[model samples]
Target: MTPEHWLNIATHGLALEAAARVRAEYLAHLEDALEAGESAEAVLREWGDPHTANRELSKAHLTTREARYLPAGYAPTWAGLGRALGEDAVPLLLFALTALAELRSGETAITLALLLAIVAAALLRWLVLSRQMLAARGRATLYWLLSFPTVLMAMSCAVLASRGAEGWHEAGRLLWERGWTGLLIVAYLLYHFSRLLTALSAARKAEAQL
Candidate 1:
C-alpha cells in the first residue's frame, strides 16, 4: 500500500471512528435538545446535520467487507433479519421515531401517519428488533400484538370502500372526496401544496412558539 493506500485506509479508519464520534455527538445534541425542552423538530434539526457528516466518508470508498459484516454475495436469512432487529439500538430508534412523531405532531392526518408508522415500527420491533434484543423475554407476545396493526390497517383499507360502518364510511368518504383519478391528474400540484402546507405550518409554528 502506497501513501494513497495508507492514506485511504488510515483515512477510512479515522472516518469510521469519527463517524461513530459524530453520531454520538448527534445523539447527544438531540438529547440536549430534549433535555432543554426543545421540540422534536429541534432534535430533527440537530440530527439532520450528521448526513453531511456521512458525506465525509466520500474521502475514500470502503470495500464491501469493510462496510458490512458479510463480504460478498451473502444472502440474508430470517435469522439474520431477526437478529439484526433484536438489538438494543434498533429498538431505541424505533422508539425514537415513534416518540418523535408522537411528540412533534398530534393531529388527524399527521397522527394517523405516525400511528401507522408506530405499527410498522412494532412490526419491525417484534419481527426485527427482538432479533437483536438479547434478553429476549416477553418478545413473542409483543411481536404477535404488533402484527395486529398491520392486519388492522390492511383490513381497514380493504373494507373501507365496502362497508357502511363508521371507519369504512370515513375511508370511503375520504377516498371519494380526494378522487384518486383527479389526484393523478394534479399530482405535482397536490404534492407541492401538501409540502408547502407542511413546511409553512412548521415554520409558522416554530416562529410563533419561539
Candidate 2:
C-alpha cells in the first residue's frame, strides 16, 4: 500500500493531534529509508500490515472519547467539561428527581443525602480521569466506584421484587413505581460501566505490547 494510505488506516481511531504526530514520525522514517537507497516496496514491507499497526496504535493513544476528558490545564474549558460529563450528569440529575419522588415526604432528607454522595463520587471520578494517566489498577478502582450506584439500585430492585415473592411481575411493579427515570439510570450506568471496562482492557493490552 502507499505510505499515505497506510498512514490513514493506521491512525483511524486516534485523536487528531496523536494521528498527526504518528504520521509525521512515520513519514520521516520513510524518507530516511529512501535516502539510504531502500526501495519504497521494501520500506512498506518493513512496516508490516496497516491494520495491525492500527490496532497497536489505537491501544497506545488516547481515543477521541478519552481525549475529551483530558483538560487543557489548571482550568478546563466549559465545553470540554460539558462533553466529558454530559452523559453522566444527565442520568445523575434524573436519578435525583425520581428518587425524591420515590421517597416519602419525611425521607426527603435521605434522598438529598444519597444524591449528594453519588454526585461527589462522580466528581471525584471526573477529577482523577482528567488529571491522571491511570494504570490498570487505577482503572479497576474507578470502575468499582462508578458501579456503586448501580449495585445499590440493583439491590433495591431485588428487595422490591422479593417483597411480593411474585417474581418478574413484582419487578415490573418496581419499575412502574420508579417510572422511566429508573430505566434511564440503569441503562446509562450499564453503558458507562461497559465503556470503562473496554478502556481498562485496552490499557492492559497496550501495556502487554510494551
Candidate 3:
C-alpha cells in the first residue's frame, strides 16, 4: 500500500492531533528506511498489516469517542469545567426531577435527603474525573461505584423475572404507582449504565497503553 493509504487506515478513528503525531513518526521511519537503500515495498511489508497496526494503535491511544470523556486540561482553562458540567448535566437534572416528584407525594424528609445525596455524589464524581489525573484502575473503580445503582436495579429485575407471572405483576404495579417518577429514575440509571460501559472500554484501552 502507498504510505498515505496505509496511514489513513492505521490512524483511522484517532483524533486529528494524535493521527498527525503517528503519521509524522511513521513517515520519519519510512524515510530513514529509504535512505538506507531499503525498497519501499520491503519497508511497508516489514510494517505488517495495516488493519493489525490500526487495532494496536487504537488500543494504545484514545479514539475520537473515548477522547470525549477526557478532561480538557491540555491548557488549563475554564473550558474544562464547562465540559465536565455538560457531561453530567443530564443525569443531575433527571435526578432532581425525580426527587421533586417524590417530594410532591409526601415523602418530604426522605426525598430531600436523597436529592442532597445524589447532588453531592455527582459533584464529587465530577470533581474527581475532571480535576484528578487518576490511574486506569482508579477510573474504573470510580465508574463502577457510580454504576452500582444500575447494577442493583438489574439484579432486582432479574429476581423479579425469575418469579414468573407474579413477579411481572408486581413490577407492573410498581411502575404504574410511581408513574413518571419511575421513568425518570430509570432514565437516569440507564444513562449512568451507559457511561459505566464506556468508561470500562476506555479504561481497558488506557491500561493497554500503560
The most accurate candidate by lDDT is 3
Query: Rank order by TM-score, top first?
Result: 3, 2, 1
Per-prediction CA RMSD (Å): 20.5, 6.1, 6.3
Best by TM-score: 3
lDDT of 3 at 111: 42
How well does model 1 score by local distance difference test? 0.44
CA lDDT of every candidate: 0.44, 0.67, 0.69
- lDDT tens digits by residue: candidate 3, 1-210: 798899899999986766888899999999999999998898889888999999999877768887665433321345644654454566557756777787757765644554455455545556676656687757666645643364346456777889988998988788778989878876887887676677667767656655
Poorest lDDT segment (10 consecutive residues) of candidate 2: 67-76
Mark the regions of model 3 whose C-alpha exceeds 4 Å error after superposition: 16-18, 69-105, 147-198, 207-210
Encode model 1's per-residue lDDT on 71-136: one tens digit a residue.
111114656444433433444456456657677556445345544555465446544443444222
TM-score for candidate 3, residues paired by index: 0.60
